[model samples]
Target chain A: MIFTIVVVGGVIGAIFFIKPVPKYYTRYGVELGTNVQITYATSKGNAKQVVDEMFKKFSDYEEIFDPWLVGSELYNLNHSDGKWTKVSPVLLTVIKDSIDFSKLTDGKFDPTVGRLIPLWGFNTDNTRNWHLPSPKEIKDALKHVGYQNVEIRGDEVRLLNGVWLDLNGMMEGYIAQMLVEMAKKNDPNSTGFVDIGGTIGIIGPKNGNEPWIVGIQDPRGNPNQAIAYVKLYSGYVGTSGDYERYIIVDGKRYYHIFDPKTGYSNDYLESVTTVSTRSIYSDGFGVFSMVAGEKAMKEMAQKIGVAYYAINENGQVIKSANWNEYEYKK
Target chain B: MNTKNKFFSKWDLLLIVFLVAGLGIWIGIKQFSPPAAKAVILLDGKVYKVIPLDKNAYYKIYRGDTYLMTVETKPGAIRATYSTNWIFPQTETTQVSVATGWISKEGETIISVPNKIVIYTEGSKERTLYDAMTYQN
Candidate 1:
């Protein structure tokens, strides 16, 4: 009788706790930006429809596939040429948010490094290419990269100079936020996750139960590995890496995550991943912390009220004072 | 047909109705549900399929060409690489490996093997590992 009770109890536990087996799942896919796929799954009525509408409402491609058009318009506005051109509310909003990040990081987080891409030949496909920028060139770029250059009035915007804005740092995070908002609309009691360009956002736990497990990507792309897994309950995460962009030559390494001051990559750290309530903060600070290094990161984490985990150039792990609070499976 | 054998009481009718409805949904899910999102992993000058089994079921895994793994997916996790003899894994190569949850001192994914790494990208196939290199732009 005791053995029977044990077997029955075990069966009941599995039935009640484990994710339902042989359960039905539906997925919807939509491509945005450099090709992002948002998948929505539920075994209920019209799961795919909800995801489809969500995609329609949110996209960072700036109207269409024409990057050059968006780039030129945004650059003209962000630079000293904002006195002209009709600025979209979307661009204005993102610029404002980026400005807030720059202030929060004390200029450590900047968005004006747009031309850096073309300079490195990332604008088009040319593998055998890379040109190091001189300090003077970097200084010139810096003049155009500050957040203050972007001025926004009631409904208009003004650019301080010929500055260009690169929203790549926060674009993914913004998409993630939109996904979470969409998920909440369908079921007041549901679990959802969205990842756009490595920026991950979540809406509650999985299936109205259990926390969502999010893995932080290793900047080095070592393979079959993860730096950390933090259980998320409606929050944001972002990663910046020295390994994010680089060039190899004669067995040497050079990356593109540049410093506004040096006109070259920040060397103090290797990778920085941050988690916070806001995706902008997470994404911006993730890059900010990498450029700022460990000492500055301690202060950055406190300033933003978030948790951070970073890897140094020599392979060292350092977390902000509050990192333990958010680490789930560490 | 025999009348008595074919006839059903109200209680029996209710039970059958419930069972049929429940089973219909279950079977429908098994039958008409859309195919899993496909991702073409570019690695070693070839494309491999990555079936991301995201526990949350809402994360879509993308490769070089299209979707690599669907969200809310729970595919089997790879604790370790299952390859015996391997080949060269270069910058644009791709591979499908599970999160052993293993990390390095620098906290990057450590794929000790060549075939274990795959890159996912856009336009150019193998998006995942394709852009892994650190381009100090």
Candidate 2:
């Protein structure tokens, strides 16, 4: 009786004295043409204020990055008529980064497909506006879609030929990383995440210790269901799939992520997810993989040292060797 | 001195019995009396409305006079049935949210990004397995 009493009393004491979990504050909304969620718990106060500030950054950056938005920096640059136009530091940084990625992937993830986007009617938010372009139209747009045509001297950028720049591929991850940097600067011990669209950047580890488990959405499954899970203690994860912003005509799906050479959405893969230490790679690799197919994806992963998990057109799961490190099997 | 008397007097025995009974009752209440789940709807990142998923009902979401979406709720589950873009109501752009069907689990969400609407559940006993999710942008 004494032993039982002691044991029960000790158990009750332990349960009562266990460390309390931190309360996480979450904010969700639409920004940068997609859903944005910011969740965090900080030892320092003013978490809500900081999160609102982060959301404001999205609209500010969208004005510069969104090519379709009239009077946006990119819009003005696109219509500069071959003259050197001075660009903002942020715009110049992303443009230079995009050019490097284009060279790295051998034009697999070119940002100069701005002409092709509007031709396919994907430049607008309303799906009613989306339509299949004729073969002649595609051919015409492909002529003006080349990353090498962009000439940058100093802080000024010049578009050669009729090429236009679309920075959508890496813009979300860049913004997410910027938000993460802000969180870290405000509080080093902050624990939270910044999700811009589907690309995610960890502000810090979960509760300052555990890895945050992130689910990867199934390409052909329900919106809330996840086909796989990844454990992210830090860094970023992003997915590019053919499911969103797609229009089906005669059972043929014409989605956004266009191929520069062919000026059509590639049918190589259904979805490609990448986990990387760099924000740009997390966002860009999926676009690169979607266009380049499986063999090129393997080669690109090797060259860039990023982990990828992909589902092919036939619904086969393929992943890189390093992907196992971040994959949560359960 | 008797061993039983020395170890636990009548008062000690009664104290032990009281504590055990209290602990059992606490555990029973925790295990059996689960709280009702609630669905939180947000418009533009602000709380628009909150509905308890304890009855069958429909909620029409509108921004001022412009109808945006309709939310359906049953006992312990909620879903978006008909959602349209505020700008282009005639043309059904994408039915991803409506096609998502019912989301009953806590942390499950149905999002209409163009409409700037989000609906998610909370206070369910079965928590979501993952902390976050990644999908096509």
Candidate 3:
């Protein structure tokens, strides 16, 4: 009877003794349909003040640092007379990064393809409208999609031809990373994670003492089954998939991630997720790996320092060497 | 104390448990978990072989005995991957000095070994193998 009482007492003790993780939220709805979300997990720390400061610094959509709103500036720059404009500093850096990616990918992922996106009517909203791009139409848009057309002179930016720059792929991941870093800067003990769209960034730790576990959406969410999941912490996780944007034809489907060579979406792989220290590298490499397909991805990852995992159409998981070391759940 | 007060007063007991658990985890993490390895596999340096696949589950065996890592094949051996080191010395674009050429001396240029991944050209008599690529244990 005494032992039973002690056991019961121990059970109660375990529950009461644990320190509850505290969660704080900071969110702002910016202009131009842009939104930012930041979450901070603390043991005994408060991050409200720090997070507010970060939001204020990053909230100026019209300023020289915001990357998301700069797409509008690039849009206007290409439409104006052939002259340079004092563009956002962050946008200038983003364009430089995109041009670098275009060179690295051999024109595979060109950011200057802004003219091509609206032509497909994807800029507004696209879930149903899918059509074949006529040869004449594609040729006209292709003229304005080269990386060499955009010139970056220090803080100023210029468009050589009528070309637009779109940082949609790089912006969300960068913004998520920026917010996480800003929170950590004020409170060294800040332990939290941010998930935007499919991109994920973790600042300190997940369980305050453990690596944060992230769930990857299964490409096929019919009855809501996870195709596969990965564990990510202290890094950025970016997933580019065929499911994001696609065109479904008679008994078949097509997607947005295009291969520049044939001007069509790839047929080999379904999704590719990359993890890296830099959010930019994670964003660029995630899309590049999908475009490179299975065989090429392995070779590139071996050469590059970034780690990644890929999911093929068959739902099989292909992981880089140390994937098992990180605690991954389905 | 009432039954409700008895439960509520358990904070004193809980505080001790919390500190002990937190300290245990803190010491455990600092004591046990090694830093994340930069180069996933280090070869031609310190030699450590995994005789058992149970504990050393995170290492890939390239060569030698210490780190004996193998792929999970229900029926057989692994099908060589591009990034992995292979038995058929890869001389592809990524692997520069890997030789597809067979060196011969005594009896013949090539010979076939059953139960092993074989290599041979058209009308060739023998197969050659120096190594095999393996996954982390």
Query: What's the i-RMS of each model?
Result: 12.5, 3.5, 23.3
- Compose the digit string of candidate 3's lDDT tens values, residues A1-330: 343466578879988997776574533223222222345665444566665565565435334332234445655666655587877666666677778878877777777766666555445322233454666776787777777887777777777677766666576667667767776776667776665444667777755676655545456542112344455558877777776345555545556565655456676667677777778766777667666788777776666667777788787888887556553654
Show where candidate 1 strays beyond 4 Å: A1-39, A42-44, A57-60, A64-80, A84-86, A123-131, A134-139, A249-252, B1-137
Tell me the TM-score that candidate 2 gets on chain A alone. Answer: 0.94
lDDT of each: 0.55, 0.87, 0.53
lDDT for residue A69 in candidate 3, whole number 0-100: 41
Docking class for candidate 1: incorrect
Tens digit of per-residue lDDT, candidate 1, span A97-117: 887888777777777677665
- What is candidate 2's TM-score for chain B alone? 0.84
| Model 2 interface RMSD over true interface Cα atoms | 3.5
Q: DockQ of all candidates, in order?
A: 0.06, 0.54, 0.01
Native-referenced DockQ of model 2: 0.54
The best candidate by DockQ is: 2
For candidate 3, give the lDDT of residue B20: 83
RMSD of each: 11.5, 2.8, 21.4
lDDT of 3 by residue, B1-137 (tens): 54555433465567658768999999998777643211111122122221221222232444444322232211111111222322321111111111212222111111111111121122122222210100000
Sorting all predicted structures by lDDT, with the top scorer first, yields 2, 1, 3
lDDT of 2 by residue, A81-142 (tens): 88999999989988999999999888989999999888867887766677888999999888
Ranking by DockQ: 2, 1, 3
